[model samples]
Target chain A: MEVIITKDLEKIYNPDTVPVHAVNGISTSFEAGEFTAIVGPSGCGKTTFLNLIGGLEAPTQGDISILGDSISTKKKSEMTDFRLHNIGFVFQAYNLIPVMSAYENVAFIMELLNRPQAEIKDRVMELLDAMGVGDKAHQRPHQLSGGQQQRVAVARALASKPKFILADEPTANLDSHATETLLDLMLKMNEKEGTTIIFSTHDIRVMNKARRLVKMDDGKIVENGKPDTA
Target chain B: MIAKLAWRNVWRNKVRSLVVIIATTLGISGALFIAALISGMMDKWVQNQIETELSDIQIHQEDFVIEEDQKFFFEKEDLERQLTAFANEIKEKAYRIKAEGLAMSAHNTYQVILLGVDPDQEPKVTNISNYIREGAYFKEPGRIKQILISQKLADELKVRMNSKVVINLSDIEGEIVGEAFKVVGIFKTSSGIFDESHVFVKNDEFAKVLKMKPGQYHELAIRTGEEVEVEAFQTELQQGLDADLMAESWIQMSPALKMTEGYMDTFNWILLSVVLTALIFGIINTMLMVVLERTREIGMLRSLGLNDRKVGLMFILETIYLSITGAIVGNILSFFLINYFGNKGIHFESWEEGFEAYGLQAVIYPILELNFYVLVTLLVFFTGLLASYFPVRKAIRLDISTAIRN
Candidate 1:
């Protein structure tokens, strides 16, 4: 089943004066359990497109539906509540709260959802173990390595059991080894847990690992298909 | 979890947090200390006035205070009868013959309030004997009348001990009378104005020249050992005394002192508000910096589905933690300092003349009521909440996407 669908989505920055079209028009859909990568060079609107799907940014003009619910018209508070239950986000900078330990970071979103504490604890620990950072649960972000922090961020994203995860340049700050390990873990989760993942990246390594690729340049998609090598 | 996060966030930058805490502590302690010092000084001033000038209660003919005329003298027998009836409630009593008059010396003449009192009873009622600055206190033995002049008045008249001064005044029948008296003592009091205006003489000697009968007196000053129950005693005396006589506590006798006591609390509140104003700005600045510095983290939290209310609460909790911690420390330190100085006293011997001019003591013991500490604690607590408002508004109003990018 299609988990996310966008129809003629457009985002314009400074539309009234010195207008820069960040995302002109994009129509796409992502099926559940798909590992999809939106690939583009800097300023090509890939991250903007991802943000729109995640409901982090409002579209200048468009319609976006996640699991058959139109999210583009939701109020800010409603959108936040929807995102809390349906959408998860991982950022390029490994945006873990510095003051929270790794375990707390994973449990934070679930806590906001008002999930049972026992269930939240079980899910958090299970996700942390799957990410191979279970032993690092009590360490703060500053005490963890870059790759470990990103793993904790992924665990945090998945803690709420969202429909899909939107990762924006998730491996941008990682070494090649850490990048491969993170990608492997995400692919394993997608296959084993039937979790849908859509990531925006300029990294060729990410594009290579993705099952489907959508390429964009200058605010418009130029190609959408599996890689020639695949 | 929110509270735990807020607690940890406050110490994220130890130096910045400590700076705010120390500033708050100093503000709280400084306000309390200044208030205590002022209260102590006022208490001392009131005490001095009561001991040296106004006794616990005073009785006079109904028109004596308003008229100050020698003709307004009441029958002293009535006062003696009341004193005998309430002897257990009374500490001491003195009958006074008061008249506005002129004191003339070899060199100068000055306007004065002539107070004639029994030397033996005046000391017990008003402690006037303790204020002798030069010579003896009515100890001279002679048929010649002896007088006690304030040192300031003595200086103005260029009169020393044993100098003869003539007091000119009206007799009870309104005839101008003059009597020559020897200045047997010089007294100095905390109030320079009182010192310069009043002269004391033996009531019998002045009464004899004024042709006043033995039972006729201008005023009766009473000392009651029950300091807190002075008003009750005054009420009882007023009920028992003749309709022509009026009994008044020291507070009623001196409206200005009573007014000063009433204004003391308002003065302390204004002072504390000024300190809290400075503290409010300091706390707002610190909390604003904390919010600004955590912009990206806040944005990330919002994107993770933490609503604006939770984020705002986090910052508010952090500010409250800092403020309450500072208030506790400040109050503890102030309590210790107040106690330390209260026992040892804060001496202003260098400003003795200045203090004495206003009837205040040279050494003051700081005193604060328990309620004052509670008020300060509440002030700091509410101040912290007020100071957090702007910064928390800024935090919750942030654009999640833009903040995250920044």
Candidate 2:
């Protein structure tokens, strides 16, 4: 089932002075349980496109439909609530709250959703153990390795059971081994939990793992198909 | 959880947070100490004036206070009879024959108010005897009429103990009369002006010199029981006095004392505001730094579904934690500091003359009521609220995409 649909989407930064077309005129849809990678060179608008889809930034012009409901018309406040319950995010920097332990960082989103304590605890530990970071659950972000931190980030994104996860350069700061480990963990979550995840990355190995690849240049998509074919 | 996060955030930059906390502690404690000091001084001033000069309440003929006229004397028997009804409230009372008179010595002359008192009864109503510095308080035997003159008046008149000072006044019949009274005691009080303008003499001698009838007095001073509310008692006592007599409390007699007592709280708040204003900027500066440094983390939180209101509330909570921690510590420190100083006393030996000029003691014991601690803490709490405004606004206004990119 199609989970997110973008119709003629566009984002223009500094529209009045020195305008930059970060994401322009892209229409696409992602299916549930799909592991997709948006691929491009530096400054080719992959992150911007992911941001637009995640509702982190409003497009200068477009209509976005999530699960058949239009989200482009939602207010900023409403959009935040929508994103909280529907879309989870992972940053390149493994942005777990520094003040929280790995377990607490994973549990943070569910807490925001006001889930029961027992449910949050079970889900957080289950996700951490699944991501292979359960032993590091009590360690703060700074005390964990980069790979371990990124694994915790992924667990946090999955904690609230969001409809989709949007990751921006999820492997950019990791070594080859950590990157492979993280990618394999994410692939397992996608297949087992049937979660749709769309991530932006230029890494060839990461792109190779995606079920589908959307290739972009400048601000528009140039290709979209099976990863090997694209 | 938000509160937990906020509290943890305060210790994130240990040195910076500690700096702000310590600054707040010193600022709040210093302001409170100064307030207590001023309160002590004022309390001493009011208490001294009441104990040594104006008793709790006084009654006089209706026109006596305004005119100081010898002819406005009231019959003492009438007030003595009415005293039986207020026996429980009345601690002691004394009658005084007050007259405007002039004192002349060989070298100088000054106008003074002559207070004629029965020495034994005067000590029961007021503490003038306790303040006698050089000579006995009406306990001497001499060949002439004896008087108690203040050291200040003696300085002006160039007289000493046992020196002859001629007092000139108008008799009740309106004729100018003069008499030589030997100065038997030289007293000094905290109030320089009071000392300079008042002298004490025997009521019998003063009445005889003024040609007044026996048992007639111009003023009747009443000392009430320590626990009695003077204002209420003044009202009750006023109602029982004869139509020709009027009763007044010390507050009515000394309006400045009443005004000072009323202004103290406002003065405390103003002092706190000045200190808090400075500390507020320090807090704002610290929170602003926290906001700027945590931009990426805050953006991450925001994008992770934390709403703007919660984010703002977290910042406010953090500021409150920082401020209240300091306030609690400061209040505890102030309690000890004030108590130590209250007992040991803060002496102002250098400013003794200046203080005595306004009827205040040279050494003051700091005092603060328990309610003041609660009120000051509330003020600091609100100050934290106020100090968080700009930082919370900045945090909420952050563009999540840009900030997360940072």
Task: Give the C-alpha lDDT of model 1.
Answer: 0.89
Most TM-score-accurate candidate:
2
TM-scores for all candidates: the values are: 0.89, 0.96
lDDT of 1 by residue, B125-198 (tens): 88678999888779746978999999899999999998999989888888988999998999988788889999
Query: Candidate 1, after superposition: displacement of residue B42 in Å?
Result: 1.6
Error of 1 at B225 (Å): 7.1
lDDT of 2 by residue, B323-353 (tens): 9988989999998999999999999989988
Tell the DockQ for candidate 2.
Answer: 0.83
- Model 1 misplacement above 4 A: A114-120, A191-193, A225-230, B76-95, B118-130, B133-146, B159-165, B180-185, B202-210, B222-243, B261-267
Backbone clash pairs for candidate 1 read B76-B215
Weakest ten-residue segment in model 2 chain A by summed lDDT: A67-76
Instruction: Please identify model 2 stretches exceeding 4 Å from their true place.
Output: B140-143, B261-266
